[model samples]
Target: MSTAIVALCFSGPTLADDVSPELVAFARTQAAHIAARTDVIEHIIAQNTNHAHLTLEEISRLDVHWRQQYGSQDSPLIHRLMNTPLSDALRSLQLRSSELITEIIIMDNRGLNVAQSSVTSDYWQGDEAKWQQTFLLGPGAEHVGELGRDESTGSIQIQVSRTVTDHNGHPIGAVTVGVAPLQF
Candidate 1:
């Protein structure tokens, strides 16, 4: 973790026509800010490199395990991800937003979670549009997911995802921020 301060902005075209401009702007600002953090970038890079050799079968296994242990207190994998400093930072960011942000998930190149504000339903997001439309799309790419109700919080929110690029401007990962439009 070099903690290098980089100035980055979301330069992609908005992908969701139904999402309001204000919500999109808010999401983009949060995504760009997170993308510019060296700690986040480094963590994603390290995780991506570490899991680069995992086969699809291995990924599915992990995903299945994660789903089985989603809300379990004894889940080793979920416990590891939720207790990290990066997860704490994400939680703090969500709290400080005064309910505008509901959740945040940082994903590696392969769509495995590097950090998250809270426990997600599943582990592998590689098959989801959030990752496919962003990390797989290239640098500056964004995907605004459809509006949905958050089960835990009972709030209507939209997931905004953007490609997280390294200092050299290469796509290394993706970040999805859950935003509640009504919070604005």
Candidate 2:
């Protein structure tokens, strides 16, 4: 009988220039959990299916309203979406792994948000690095965004994204997860 051991590693924060082998290993392990969770992935896909029929006009209208109401202030969309069953469902799903997750955002194929765990700065994420990497790169590609500080919590985090795909492996949407590095 034989057993295999897997090792994990992570580079420290950009400014610190300190690399903790243990934290690196922890991050790698937590990253696995983030990537391999079927339930989380499925929730995102289910949301994509729910909004698959959305027209550009509808998204545009919401975007316009969001911008007008929130402008540079804290986004009110979170509260708006939270009132809906869709966001409620997502919030419930997120609660299952709240310890490891900082934020969750589900976006349609067009990069417009279908639902989110919290209010974001905008309704569209198409131009962001995370969306481009996950949605544009097609399925099987995971986008690991650069580590940054969460303005609200002031905690360092790394954003990760994966393309949402249909049973036939066609790209449908994308899901982004903000993870606190220390938790890993």
Candidate 3:
């Protein structure tokens, strides 16, 4: 990727002045790597078909269900997400990052969680800027969210998101990597 795209990844309102350039670059690299993976692309394409017909109300219901079962051991939805090979891959990435990465989440074209390294506050991310600024903006777009405390990791972090595209360069989904800047 060009330096300009990397710079753009960290630009805009969500870019915090206190965040380290090295850390931002690291996150951007991770995002791009994840986006290029064939498994990630294939999984998202499959999910897009599964979720294509879901209405807004159905998404809200699923989100509500996810929130209600957030910490419970009996959540089928969470189980399905966490048990996937993709989720395992994400978790492995997070573990290998030596805590620089707090979490990783892969969302489908509709922004519903396809796989996640950890349980998120909600299932649907379509309404969030991470999804909008990346997937909605088209391929190669990125969004670095403002620094905040990640509930799962309990670390102050920023979520760096990038659009996932297929071989045709069509937007398939988005991946968000939560990085703890203090780890830099």
Candidate whose lDDT is highest: 3
Residue-wise C-alpha lDDT for candidate 1, range 1-184, written one tens digit per residue: 1111111012222234555678778988998898789989999989988998999999999999998898777799889888999999999999999989988999999899999998888899999999999999999899888666655455667788999999999999999998876566
The TM-scores, one per candidate, come to: 0.87, 0.63, 0.90
Best by TM-score: 3
lDDT of 1: 0.84
Q: Rank the candidates by TM-score, best first.
A: 3, 1, 2
- What lDDT would candidate 2 get against the real structure? 0.61
User: On a 0 to 100 scale, what is the lDDT of residue 64 in model 1?
Assistant: 96
- lDDT for model 3, on a 0 to 1 scale? 0.87
Question: Roughly what TM-score does model 2 have, to 2 decimal places?
Answer: 0.63
- Order the candidates by lDDT, highest first: 3, 1, 2
Two-way lDDT contest, 2 vs 3, winner = 3
lDDT of each: 0.84, 0.61, 0.87
Comparing 1 and 2 on lDDT, the stronger one:
1
Model 3 steric clash pairs: none
Regions more than 4 Å wrong, model 2: 1-61, 67-78, 151-154
Candidate 1 off by > 4 Å: 1-16, 151-154
Put down candidate 3 lDDT per residue, 92-182, tens digits, no spaces: 9999999889989999999999998888989999999999999999988999888766676677788899999999999999999998766
